[model samples]
Target: MNWRKRFRTFWNRYASQVLRKILPRLESMAARLSSTDDTQELSEILATYKMSGFPLPMSFTDVDTVIENALSTGVHLTEAKNAEFALAVHIHPYPSNVLAVWVYVAVLSRKS
Candidate 1:
């Protein structure tokens, strides 16, 4: 595996143990500091939150296998005409871009 995957695997194995040992001490120290001072604590919290401005990119950049398995391995026509007929029959009955279409698919797919 590449360095990124290796790093992730290493982190998954040890990061939790490290955090578990350190988090309580950090919380106790924070509590002690805030109890002694209020305004300074609030400002520090706001500053930290601001400094931690969320990381960008919603998902991973490189994707190798987009799909692990198909919905079925059975017989079915795979063409634009087949899709056109299927959509015209089932989807037209439902509101476009709505949850009803998803619900219909989920329900219909499990019928067999």
Candidate 2:
């Protein structure tokens, strides 16, 4: 096969494997976050995001940062109830830039 064909084959195989491994993990994590109370769930989600390689922004330490990042990045978030949030982000590379797509759904936590 030519180099282009070889590259394509390699990329497809790699992407498929990576997605298969990561998707289930992501789903499980999201489910866990979605099922709990607002504070606990948000904490877990932030921790997961940090552990998953997206470091928290140094300038802000509130849930707003998470929401903003999710929106700015083009993640696709679903419906949210009171004091809850959920979103998915996809990152892609371009020739001269990186694109982050975020979709966000969120509900503010009840203040004490």
Candidate 3:
């Protein structure tokens, strides 16, 4: 299966809330920032990220892929490449569920 679809499936299983709203907001925001200046976009993502609950069924590497995919503006995953790893946060909701979430912000550049 394609990575995008895999990401959606991963979200369905692990994401704390539905991404239908926030994702587009992020995409629009990312789209607005110049690809060369993904630092701004990465900062926005790190500053705004607030996911809670759900354990990761995947790895940090998988998460890096998700961040890269979700924020990508290209027509396909192959059409974009991560230019930088700005930040990565691993959240473990304490006490009960022990949910592990890997949150990250990345800079993506259009493929040449």
Candidate 4:
């Protein structure tokens, strides 16, 4: 397998475990922060995750710094209630930049 394939496999497993650990907390946070655009608080939550040892790929930068850079470079977060979290990185910036972005949107509705 090539290096890219190996990295992708590793990331898939790692990200799955991370989500299983953090999804509930994230759901609650999303609910509370839904009324306001509070990226700082959200980033703080992510920072805690990173600080806990699950540092994001690409060096050891904190989550907030990554977010700040993404915002500066043009990233968007939809206002829909289902919009949970998003991760984006710029891979190539020549002629037209290539972005690797992933957004996890989940809908929670209680049947009454």
Model number with the top lDDT: 3
TM-score of every candidate: 0.20, 0.21, 0.24, 0.21
Candidate 3 residues 77-99, lDDT tens each? Answer: 33222322222344434355553
Cα-based lDDT for every prediction: 0.22, 0.33, 0.35, 0.33
State candidate 2's TM-score.
0.21
| Candidate 2 Cα outliers beyond 4 Å, as residue runs | 1-82, 108-112
What tens-digit string does per-residue lDDT give for candidate 2 at 28-60? 445463342334433544443321222222223
Question: Which of 3 and 4 is ahead in TM-score?
Answer: 3
lDDT of 4 by residue, 1-112 (tens): 1312222211223334444445434434444643433345435445433311221223223556555544443213223332223332322122344322222222121122
What overall lDDT, based on C-alpha atoms, would model 1 receive against the true structure? 0.22
Worst 10 residues of 1 by lDDT: 101-110
lDDT of 1 by residue, 29-104 (tens): 4346333323443243344222111101111222222111111211122221211101100111224533111100
Pairs clashing in candidate 3?
none
Off by over 4 Å in 3: 1-82, 85-87, 109-112
